[model samples]
Target: MATLVSILLLLAMWWLTMTTGALAISPGRVVATLTGGGTRIENLVIIDRRLSRLLAGSLIGFCLGTSGALTQTITRNPIATPDILGVSAGAGTFAVLALVRPETTERLLGVSTTVALVPVAILGGLITTGVILTLGWRGGFDGYRLVLVGLGINALALALTSWLLTRAEVEEASVAVRWLVGSLGGVRMGDVVYLAPMVVLAVLVCLRLAGGLGALRLGRDIGQALGVSAGRTEAGALITAVALVSVATAAAGPIAFVAFVAPQVAMRLFGTAGPPPLASGLVGALLLVGADFLAARLPLELPVGIVTSVLGAPVLLYLMTRHLRRTSV
Candidate 1:
């Protein structure tokens, strides 16, 4: 029922995305256009343009949310998320490098400047995650240590990104800055196609592992008693979360806070003790789509990340305060 509500909300948000832009089309006309019965202008605006942005946002959000669920489950901590894995900072560093100094980045990466950003960003994120995993693994995974180690690496990556921006000309840095803030503005159909398979596979994987994840969250002894291998589930969840976030950061330039906020929100919405990957994904879609919608309409116009951060910060504060109260009790 919670998932159903989330889906309905997501659909409603998508409708708003389609119907409420400049030169507004009615909801019925938008549906007709989507179903292939509208004028050229409507098709151009809806199909060729808006649809791609919406799809990209939805896909990115789903991946981030699912990743967050997996991470939170493994760590048994609401605050643990893909953001703590250094993926965003690493991806942003490489992306900024590509945007601000395409020639140097291309030479270093041995890819055409045109295609270097995504792949380079992916490489950077993966490399950063690998480094974190290496240093933070203490006989078994230590969630707290991992977060701490990842923070240091993430800081370095963000610092590198900042230095690059400062050295580059403003024209070169302008595009980099927007990408860092996480906009769906540049998303096109091809990017959506690139992300769909991974997003679908991630969801399926999450579903398949859901039971094990739930048990593992109860603690190791109980998980083993329930015939779920705690080590295997933890490792699988961690790997999946890392991969999903890396790919998403590469694709969307590190949209802020979705991975941190989605799973916790899902848990509260569903009144569950643990995050449900499916519901988290749905809420994530709603959040990003709604953020993009709001971003488009706002007079001060900002990136989707800016909108997400604005909305999510208060939620994070609430969750933190609640957690503090529980611990105090």
Candidate 2:
């Protein structure tokens, strides 16, 4: 019931946002446009422009939130998000490279730039995750070691991304900067079309694996004792997390801390001890759409990522402080 209400509120906000951009349309007009009754201009603006951006933002948020829940579940750590774990950084690095140096990626991958975006980003995220898992492995996953290695890798990826930006043409750099900051201003229907199927597939996989994931959360030995393949469950969760984060990053350029913040917020709202994957996804969509709306209304028209970062920083700090207190106790 709560989730349903939240979704309705978010949809309402999304509709209002679509109706009130540069060339404002009223709610009735926006509804008319959707129902094929508005002027051509209204139809174009509402359908082609605003709706695409809204869908992209919503899908990205849903993916990130669900991905974050999976990561935190598998790692048994509240802070184990794609951004903090370097998955987003890896995916973002490859995505930026694809944007700025399409020829290089094409030459190396023997695929056109358009065909390589999501796959290349996914590969980067998987490779980074593989490295983190390998380095952090001490017969099994260690949350602390995973975090340390991931942070290190994330730093390296960011540095490489910065260096690449420095080498790009001025115009390309400008475009890449907007993407890196997770802007939704220029998203089109094609992006939504490309991302929607992938998000759906990933969500289905997450649902299929949810039971195993829950069992694994009871600890490796206990899960194994209960006939769950701890290794398989962990691997599945990691791959799902990577796929979700990679696709979202490719679509929206990391989008800051949505993955990290959404699950926690959802857990709080639902008063659940474990991350609620579906609810988290909804919360994520809401957070992102709300952020995008605020960004559009802001005087400077900042990227949605900036808004999320500003909001998430305090939550991250509070989580860290709470984690510390728990450990000390």
Candidate 3:
């Protein structure tokens, strides 16, 4: 109920933000615009521009949140997330590469560069995840080892991204920087159209696997005893998480920490031991929309990822300190 209310409030804020800007419109006018009863300018600004951005931000948030919850559950670690596990970094690196070096990707993939971003990003994320899993596997998945490997891969991906940026032309490099920072400024309805269906499909798969994922928190042996195929369940969950993060990264350039922070925040709000995938997705949507709104309102408009990182950094520190203290004890 609280989550529902929070979502409603965020939706209201999102609508308000979309409707009002340089040329302000009232909430009533925004509603009328949505319902097809607004001036040409209002329609152009609200329907064409802001609505697309809002939808993109919301979907990206939902994907990240859902992916984050699944990742944390899979690893049995509160801080585990796609970003920390190098999935986002890998996706971002490949997407930027595709953007800056279109002909190379076009030649390799036998497709238009425009059509290759999501697929390349997904491939990168999957490959990175496979490496992390392989390096971390020791008879069974080890949380600490997985995190360590993921961090190393993340560093490597970042270095590669920096190198790629250096290779880009000045204009392409500027575009890459905005993408790296994660903004919705360039998003359009076409981008939303590409993102929404993938998110919906991934989300359906997540809902179907939610029960098995919940069982995973009890450990592999117990989960197997409960009739869950530990291996298959883990594989399915990881694939879904990778797909979710990949599409989200492809859409918004790897918005940082939404995946890491949203699930933890949802768990705290609901007072639950395990991350709730659906609720966490909603929380993520709210967080991103709110962050985008705040980012736009800043003296100089900032990337939504910058805002989320600012909010999430302190939370990350808190979680790390708590983890260290618990381990020390």
Off-target runs (Cα >4 Å) in candidate 2 are 107-115
TM-score per candidate, in order?
A: 0.91, 0.95, 0.96
| Ten residues in sequence with the least summed lDDT for candidate 3 | 13-22
Q: What does the lDDT read for residue 135 in candidate 3? A: 87
Ten consecutive residues with minimal summed lDDT in candidate 2?
186-195
The number of the candidate with the highest lDDT is 3
Task: For residues 87-191, write the lDDT of model 3, one tens digit per residue.
Answer: 899989989999898778899999987679889899999998988888888876677888899999999999999999998998878878888888888788878
lDDT of each: 0.82, 0.86, 0.87
Relative to the unseen true structure, what is the C-alpha lDDT of residue 247 in candidate 3, on a scale of 0 to 100? 86
TM-score of 1: 0.91
Q: Quick one: best TM-score, which candidate?
A: 3
The local distance difference test score of model 1 is 0.82
Q: Candidate 3: list runs displaced more than 4 Å.
A: none
Q: What TM-score quantifies how close candidate 3 is to the native fold?
A: 0.96
* Alpha-carbon lDDT of model 3: 0.87
